[model samples]
Target: MTTAIRRRGPDADGAWVDTDRGVALGHRRLSIIDLSPGGAQPMESADGRYVIVYNGEIYNFADLRADLEAAGQAPGWRGHSDTEVLLAALSAWGLDRTLAALNGMFAFALWDRAEGRLSLARDRMGEKPLYHGWVGQGEQRTLLFASDLAALHAHPAFRPEIDPASVSQLLRFGHVPDPASVYRGVGKLAPGTRLTLSADGGEDAFVYWDTLSEYARAAGEARFRGDAIEAVDELERLLGNAVLRQSVADVPLGSFLSGGIDSSAVTALLQHNASGPVKSFSIGFSESAYDESPHARAVAAHLGTDHQELIVTPEDALAVIPDLPGIYSEPFADSSQIPTYLVARMAREQVTVALSGDAGDELFAGYNRHVHAHRSWPRLARIPRPLRRLAGRAMTAVSPARWDAAIGPLVARKAVGVGEKMHKAAGVIASRDGDALYATLISVNPDFRELLRHPSEKDGFEGRALEIVAGLPLPDRMMAMDAIHYLPGDILTKVDRAAMAVSLETRVPMLDVDVIRFAWSLPADMKLRDGVSKWPLREMLYRHVPRQLIERPKQGFGVPIHDWLRGPLREWAEGLLFDSAASLDEYFDRPAIAALWQRHLSGAGNHQHRLWPILMFQAWRARS
Candidate 1:
């Protein structure tokens, strides 16, 4: 099982078994911190009460070690890996206290020999993954857990059955939300949670840290009494500290610079604090509309960092298609996974650790939906429901191309996405409330429930963990929803799988617990004001790079998937959707998919987003 996940840790492999207790633990080491046998796993405590196999890094391990020493609980450490510090902390402070004090990304399995208990935990932001479930029935049942599903598949007792509800969810959200995996009986441990199981089959799960609770606490406290300028300055300090802590790696480290506010801010702070130039990596595309390499280059040159870039062709992305199922180990349909994988592969050539600017958007209200909810929703709401629906129908009456042509002469070429945005906004305007509006904005298939063979038990928006913040302001509620759902489920999942596929460790500084709490405490106006989303974040970023260079519209870190599906990828897509129609009939309504494909080929409208998920699922089905 450990050998199956060697790509996640190629440096070393080890196994420890306790036949007397019917327990075994295995590990694959990437050797990021302490580069000696002292850092090896499955590591045991000096007292031999605890054994743990851990993945991911602890940026504040040094601080935690100092605290342990100050508290007079420090074990005379043999080596300086975070794992040793963690094990010591666990032995001293207990699981809950150790997890609460952590400021890093990690997923670990800790076994307590003294008590015959097993504990599993994931990082607060879902940066690392932990999958656990029982296999077999009644007396034959055996519990299985691993960082990757392939490892679980390696166990003879493991049997994976596809869950139709989760497949429908994949078609809806582009990724399966946590607490539910694509396979039945297996489940992802939610972030900020710890699950403990005893030898007699007693199990309990507790949330050690939760973003929803933090959001509520921040909102209730109403802290950050300072004005906007003070907020920005404090934010800068918090982010700077986060970057510095995450920069603690014995191996070469860098940042993924997209020239956007988020990555640019992280890159600038990294260079500002590093003794020398920090290695920054980005990828370019021949599709001018989709490429951000020039902007990243400008930022890199301005920052004077060691910059490297690759101009990727369509073939480069196409080459990665066949590898997606294995790379993700499930049916994930996020098209940007191509560029994310490419950039990670590029960085792996130069560095082992890379920091990203992922959760800033979710934490700081940087998504377009946040801005639209703030600016457009009130006006749209003022119109009666019937009128709003009429307006939405009217907007969709014209094709996206015609709408683009009508507005093309007035805006810059990069703003051509405006028409598609308008099309999406029209659909959202018909929503009855903020929840419905947010749901419409994020949905890839609004009517997926109807398209599936069996009725879906839950819609994308149902059973989410974000209901805690439902009574907050529309923008805050939406941001909270995104932080709990989209940030972890889609963004973090995409980066983790893509980067790990290349044996690279990617960290997100913006998601530091302190940073997240601070971001939520600020007044809503500080996050989005006067039609500018992420205003405070932009203010902080401006202190590093010129506003003009970074002030452009937000572009997704993406490939030209729409163009690819219609052009070079047409035959491949057709083979999956049409030639293999018989295979998909078990899940999809064939006539509906065929009609959508035909409409897309005719250029009547862009159905690529709708079609891509089907292709990904079909491709994954073929492999699974």
Candidate 2:
């Protein structure tokens, strides 16, 4: 895993093992601080009872160390890497209390020799990635884990089995939710939570902290602008300090400049603070809708940075599809992984460490889903349940306007119109009496039952869905939903696997705990206002760059998969869908899968949703 992540920092590599306890930890160092050998891992505590394998930079290690010193528990001195500081803190204060004091993006595994326990934790927003799985038993009882799925795949015990519910969720959204992996036995650690496994065969897992509600009530909009400006200023300070800290490596370091607000902000700040032009890289596409090369070029030129670009073709993306199972060690369906992987490769060609502008959207309510949900609640409340059914029926009866007729009419009616989807979405939350808000945020596959091969399959994930959703309070449910469901299951997982497959390390600055706390504390209006999403983030971006540069409609960073499967990828799609005439009963209903493909190919219904999963499943099953 460290070797795969070496592009993020090629300067050093080390592994720590406790063979006596049958455990091993590896570190792929991207030396951002304390470049000497003193910063190595698995860093040991003073008494040597605790050891850690950590990924990511901690921006506040200095202050943390000071606090420990003030308490008179001076740690054994070592190199300047945050690794040593984090280990010391874990040792002195213990896991639960120490985690409360951290302010960074991290995923770490700490082994306590004295207690004969293993603890795994991810930063609050899951800015970093961690994957784990159990193998055989009895002494060799294999339980392996890593920062990326590819490393776990290297182990002999790894077995790949498709999780049906994960497939359904992927089709509805773009990524799998936490605690569920594409491979049946492998799972991701939930963000803001910890898991401990012990030699006594006992296991414990629970949430350590969550800031959504606290941030929601922190301050009102009347004070938000001033607070926001201060927040941005502070963010600038944190980011600058983080980059400088991360830049302290023994190897070459670089940054990714997508020319989007986040990347541009990072690149600009890095250049402003650095003594020389920073090395940056970007990925472009031939397809116009997916192309951000022009904007990337503009940003690179403005920053006067050393930049390189790679314009990839559809074939370039398709070629990597086969490698998905190996890299993800699970069944992941996020299409943007293609671009993420390519960009990582481009940056790896020139430098080791690179910075990314991830998490801005989540922190600042940048997603249209959040705004749409906020706006649509009022309208949904006005419609009575009986009327909703009648209206749905009326809409369904209307003929297609020059399009295919059968399911199109049903789609036209049941579908929330682009303008009304958000409002109608409020129906999920408007009741104000239940967990409908969370249900609204996560109902993309409400009709999942329609696609299941058997009615019995619905029972599989129902308990999981209720348990996770029920555990969170109203104020935190949405963000918590994202943190647990979307962030690692999809976003972080997508970036980690894609980048690591190419030996790249992508760091998320906005996901820093401090920024997350600020995001949580801002008033709802600051997050969503005037029907505009991510209002505060918009305010922040306008400070350093012109709004005209990025004030256009949001275009998702995705491939033309829907079109391609209907076009160039049709043959491949069909072969997978129809070829398994003999042995299809164990996985999917072959007839149902074939019918969906036929419907899509015939344009009877846009069955892309139904087809994508089947195609991806077949491809993944073959490889696994």
For model 1, residues 222-332, the per-residue Cα lDDT tens digits are 557888999999999999999999998889999999889999999999999988999999999988988999999999999999999999989988999988988988888
Candidate 2 residue pairs that clash = 8-352, 182-331, 215-520, 215-521, 216-520, 376-422, 376-423, 377-426
Which prediction has the highest TM-score against the true structure?
1
The total of clashing pairs for model 1 equals 0
Best by lDDT: 1
Candidate 1: pairs in clash: none
Mark the regions of model 2 whose C-alpha exceeds 4 Å error after superposition: 1-20, 26-37, 69-72, 137-142, 148-164, 183-185, 211-250, 393-446, 455-477, 581-584, 604-606
- lDDT string for model 2 (521-602, tens) is 6655656667777666666666666677767666567776766788888887777666764244555666666666665565
Give all TM-scores, in the order shown: 0.98, 0.83
Model 2 residue 10 CA deviation in Å? 7.2
Candidate 1 segments exceeding 4 Å error: 416-419, 462-467, 580-582
State the TM-score for model 2: 0.83
